[model samples]
Target: MKIKLIAAAAIAALGFATSAQAHKAWLQPSQTVFSDKGAWLTVDAAVSNDLFYFNHVPLPLERLRITAPDGSAVQAQNASTGKLRSVFDVELAQEGTYKIAMVNEGMFASYKLGGEAKRWRGKAEDFKAGIPAGATEVSASESLGRVETFATVGSPTTGVFKASGKGIELVPVTHPNDLFAGEKATFQLLVDGKPAAGLKIEVVPGATRYRDQQNEIHLTSGADGKFEVNWPQAGMYWLETASEDAKTTLPDAKQRRLSYVAVFEVLSQ
Candidate 1:
């Protein structure tokens, strides 16, 4: 399957979060591809009165719907998470065009007062399979602290990353042409020169402050030995990966660690 990951500039610009009335909400990968035999749709909502006072809000399943080209509407199933943000999974069978739409009520008011609702539309195709050779590994980690002030927000105290096993190559998704708003990107984690399994991956977008608190997005690996999320907004962001086992140890103490984390710009198309 040809998995095209699109990282487009956010249609809406990022600015300071001033009051509860200015919080914004939107879907990532505003565009997308359906190539997996079965596909999963992951939605993240960021609510901020101003950019600095951002909160990852949990959206209810009833708030959104996925409608296929065939006119079949699928409801999203709630996924597990430890944070305030809510994740929903929708299974796609035969593919064509799909539209993700939000219900115009309830939480819609919160999003509207803060911002507005947006949609991600695209095609879903069959995903191809094959293993690549000589894969490299990349890893990264960063410490998150509460926001103290607007202008002098402190840097992460400690950060580190490591690659799991052997075969997986960790490539930086940096170039503007590499990702867009409505597509999905795939990277392999190899084990002894083969696709690795049970790896832990973390994606952190730049931090913004709201109500004197700091907010970030965190993703764990799925059953496919891969971690995927939609990038709807543009700004500076980081992708970090490490062996699931290594997570048990402190960042300063770890063996067999190979990680990658780099800063990338998500520009508007």
Candidate 2:
């Protein structure tokens, strides 16, 4: 089935305490593919950096959802969250691919005094604590962060790679779950359910050892909203893109930025 369009709604994020460093969410599994009849999959997740270990904190379970191998919704079981990490387990019931997605969006305000930008903060409840009394004006905007990944139990399936129709989605022209090092994979960027042309995309090694921003491959989508990249080595990687909207009428800001991220692996030859 093709992607169904859904309106990107703002999440009411109040009383959210965030770390100083920018936190990005990722999904890591004990094994990407299963060979046993009763294999179980374990996953560790967090809004973190420096590889799997948490640099920020764990993402709330309410923000996550999973689609199973046969395209049925699967609930993440035994979920737990702590200061450093979040872990969960999923039991495999089929022999195809499974997809997990986490989405978060909220309103943010930027403080400026005499045209000098001071700070930016999200969650309506943090406004008083974030903005100082001397601030002359405040601009408000909407923001969004999205993450997606896949795991398989035998051969990979394409059911979950279809766009979710909400943000800057990467629709794989080549099968995302069947990538290999040294092979070029193509993807189409869709912004709000339509082709997104001239968008910048970054493909970076997902490991902390190779995560220098200089090592990332940067590409731009063409008129067809498609871009291609070839992995230099076998490893997990992240593909991300973002866009800004200046049409927000929110009381706190003038513009908004939306970002999308996806994680996948390229197998060794």
Candidate 3:
């Protein structure tokens, strides 16, 4: 996975003085789920205060569009949060790739934060729908299963979760049930059908090739074998979980493994 950090230099080069408009970045949604009914596309954007430090007022969204593979345009409404967020809902009846574009509206122009007015543009492509034949769709039940099994057989088993000590377990957490921006949920890894404790975990938001950016989070399992992380913004985030091992341990002992990951949407609340 490609990870791009928005450096201050890059942001400055975009024409904003270092003092104003600290950083401007896009939060791309990682997963798009399609079904016979329609397709659900979730898009997120992240604007740091530093990036907007110089601006007189908050920048508002101007135009947001979604184009289907067949050249059909889907009208996207600014769902919940109006100014600070750029989110859209597009319906898809057929199977194909989709392209989305969002532009910041007049607010930025009026303030003239930068010498030359600029608009934020973001694009998300290949939004897909429908399920493959053999792949079972992820659901709340499946999410529960993985958590249950992981906690049950820790170090002793080949399953993702392994028992590290008498009361501790180590497991890897990844997609299909991974973390997302603006979400608070918990899934556990059981040790012999009991809650495992002190498991270290990391959540990395996925990146998009179109924009070249990514975000990540680090967390730990609680006494109840549950881990909680909140995505403060919208973007594709990758969730990773592993046992905390000492530096003195062998390299193999510290290897990170894939658990389960799922794409999620964070709407304006």
Candidate 4:
């Protein structure tokens, strides 16, 4: 990619939480459904208290991944990190769906050396080596987080919706680009690339700053890892869910945190 995107080494997200007061991270595209084949799509990535409003900090795109309609990797162009958000552009040369994702995996550690508290955040592979000698009360945790948004030039394609089977992910049974208000959309939630039954899903609409209530919708995946959402209105919505287990890839880490966040635009039918 010609754009100077952030490095994965720079990611410092603490962990994933479903708290209402927690700052939510997201990616918002200028337009979700494009009519032209060669259209240009711009995206803004940020983390903030009020959904879609960039107030807290810019989300680093070190682990950013773009997949074209043909299941090919596409490089972002003219990308830049600003004070409040990171901006990027993608040329929709194909006439199908494109997936823009920021995937991250790292560790958070806390220990004591010489009776002093110390903390670290970086790749999980470095968790053991990064620990200083004589560090007592050493404890660490691994985290995997993904933020994504989809854009389609003409018609949406299913090739870009494949799951990595590593952390938690969403495989849309109902095409994302085909979402319509008042209609129910179905999706398969996966953990470790398998059906994630009984996982809680949170769906919150944008423009939360104007409403006194969050209006967040909560749903759970069925036994087959499928979940359904009936959009109430025509607007951009933030959907997120997380799962935790003792399946840490690192020996020193005791727990693994897996989270998924996606932005979807529901059109009025």
lDDT score, candidate 2, position 200? 78
For model 1, the superposed segments whose C-alpha errors exceed 4 Å read 1-21, 29-31, 49-56, 80-83, 106-269
Clash count of each predicted structure: 50, 4, 31, 0
lDDT (Cα, tens digit) per residue for candidate 1, span 231-265: 76765444444332233123322222233232333
Please give, for residues 1-269, the per-residue lDDT of candidate 4 as tens digits: 10001112113443322234457789999979999988899999988888889887888777889999998899999999988888999999998999999988888777999999987888777777889889999878787878889999877788887777898888988999999999999999889989999888889999999989999998989999999999999999999887778998888788777778899999999
lDDT by residue for model 2 over 1-269, one digit each (tens)? 00100111222232145432334456777767677445777777766656546776676677787888667898788889888777888888878888877776667665677778865556545656777778876666766657777778777677776776665777778877778899898988887778899887767676664555536688889998999888898888866677777744355656666667777778888
Predicted model with the maximum TM-score: 4
Q: In terms of TM-score, which candidate is stronger, 1 or 4?
A: 4
**Candidate 3 stretches greater than 4 Å from native:** 1-22, 33-37, 49-59, 78-83, 103-269
My TM-score estimates for the predictions, one after another, are 0.31, 0.77, 0.30, 0.91
Q: In model 2, which range of ten residues has the least summed lDDT? A: 1-10
Better of 2 and 3 by lDDT: 2
Give all candidate RMSDs, comma-separated. Answer: 21.9, 6.3, 19.3, 5.6
Worst 10 residues of 1 by lDDT: 144-153
For model 3 the TM-score comes to 0.30
Candidate 3 global Cα RMSD: 19.3
